[model samples]
Target: MTAISETSAQMALRDPDVRVMLRVRADEPGAFAELVGQYQHRLVAVMHHLIGDATEAEDLAQEAFLRVYRARKKYRPRSKFSTWLFTIANNLARNSLRSRQRKPVTPFVSSESGSMGPHEQMVKDNRSGPMQKVQRKELADLIQEALAALNERQRVAVVLNKFEDMNYAEIAEVMGLTTKGVKSLLSRARMNLRAALAGYVYMDGAPAPEEESERPV
Candidate 1:
């Protein structure tokens, strides 16, 4: 009887799709497509939050896949297959942001009228209310502004933590940071979000009450 190795790569092999990715590495038929089918939506979602444009997010997600395909020969899974995949995503999103900074635009225009963008998705997922009464797109715009107030690194970390539901250690692996560094980054990001959204409607879509003293002025 042979003992199993519990290393990340070995553990990752347990995921059927990761095994497909391994076959992709070996140039097997349809394996790459299988891997892409599994992660395309997720990758695009993360890219949308990071870059704030749906069209661009789709492009970047495709680019990430291309890069992964190209790097297949060198693929060595030191972490979960998704972790490795997102590390590639993280780099592409940051690069896109930096490129965008060279030529500033007004803002991202939603590619469609009715579909929810990344910020709206976050707001709806993180908070709940009788949203039918409010303009969802406008509320999403407000949240997007709050997200914009954070610097690039904070924004990226926040998206990964919140939207991706990744823990600090996992985020560290993705972002190439220590666990403590991730903690500090997320802490500052949350504080900035609070300050930015203060006195506005809360995430749950309720009005924020004003604080006042009974003594009066």
Candidate 2:
């Protein structure tokens, strides 16, 4: 085998998801469904964060899966399966956002009903009374707004880093950026999110004092 194929083989050996995808490539029954079941919620959540519309996010997620299925025959284990999947999702999100820019419509207003991000979990763990529930809902709304305020690339980087828990190298692979570029991108995203959420809450779900200015402006 060629050196690249050897590397691919090594990667496939290292990642079980890649092996599953290889099964998909081989037309193994149920492999594609297994892949979808494993990733559907995550893919949809990432898409929702990217696009800001739950329905559109579902559509994009489905499209991403469709593309993955159609391109299974060309699958190569050059990177982690999740990274490759999100790369496709990122492309679709960018295209959808660009199209929306050309023909603006009323923005979709989605509640944080089914969200299970860090902040949501924090709130869930702390829910003690109706007042706390109200606070949790407000915090969730503020967080969503803060996320929406970020520019597209920054939002993508932040979502991949914070939500997906992807390391810099993985994010770089998914985003088609150098590692340094991913670092810089995440730095800017952090600054933007801090600025957007200043005096409200920290990214770690800690409440920020009204007078706190420790976070970079």
Candidate 3:
């Protein structure tokens, strides 16, 4: 076996999810369902952020899982199971986006039982006041707009980084880019997001009061 495949085999042995997937590949009972239960929410959320339509996202997520099951016989652990799964998702999402001629749709954020989605969580204030809730909603809208402003590749890179908590190397593997390329892609994405959300959000730290005063109304 090649060195890279050998390393991946080691990783497969260590990753519990990979083991579960291997079981599915072997037609073990309930393994496929377990895999879906483990990753369905995460995959749907990622697809939602990528494509911006909740229904379409669900469809895409289901398709991704279907593809995984269909490809089970050929499955080989070249990386973490999540990485392999998301690589499929990323490709599907990209294709869907490309097929549409219109601008990207605004992402829909769903809340359940007063819980916040990732964008809301990021910009939500600690205060429980009504105004704070309004402001949080506004910030969430702006953040979603900012994300939509990024190109498909940049959006994917940022989503995987922020939402998936994947490091540069893992993201590189999923996106078929070199590590350096992923870094550069994220750098540009951050710059674009910061520009899009300039007055409302700070990329590094909170702006000084004086600087805040200078922000456009």
Please give the CA lDDT of all the candidate structures. Answer: 0.79, 0.82, 0.83
Q: Indicate which candidate wins on lDDT.
A: 3
**lDDT value, residue 187 of candidate 1:** 97
* Candidate 1 local lDDT, 155-194, one digit each (tens): 8899888988889988998999999999999999999888
Ranking by TM-score: 3, 2, 1
- Residue pairs with backbone atoms closer than 3 Å in model 2 (clashes): none
What is the number of residue pairs that collide in model 1? 0
Best by TM-score: 3
TM-score to true structure, per model:
0.78, 0.79, 0.80
Candidate 3 lDDT tens digits, 143-192: 77679869889999999999999999999999999999999999999999
Candidate 3 lDDT score at position 143: 75
Instruction: Give the C-alpha miss distance for residue 78 in model 2, angstroms.
Output: 1.0
Worst 10 residues of 2 by lDDT: 125-134
lDDT of 2 by residue, 1-217 (tens): 6897788668766998998999999999999999999999999999999898988999999999999999999988887899999999999999999999899764443445445543454445455432335465666666686788688998899999988999998898888899999999989989987765554544355545643666567
Ten residues in a row with the worst lDDT in model 3?
125-134
* Clashes within 3 Å, all models in order: 0, 0, 0
Candidate 2 regions exceeding 4 Å error are: 1-5, 108-134, 202-217
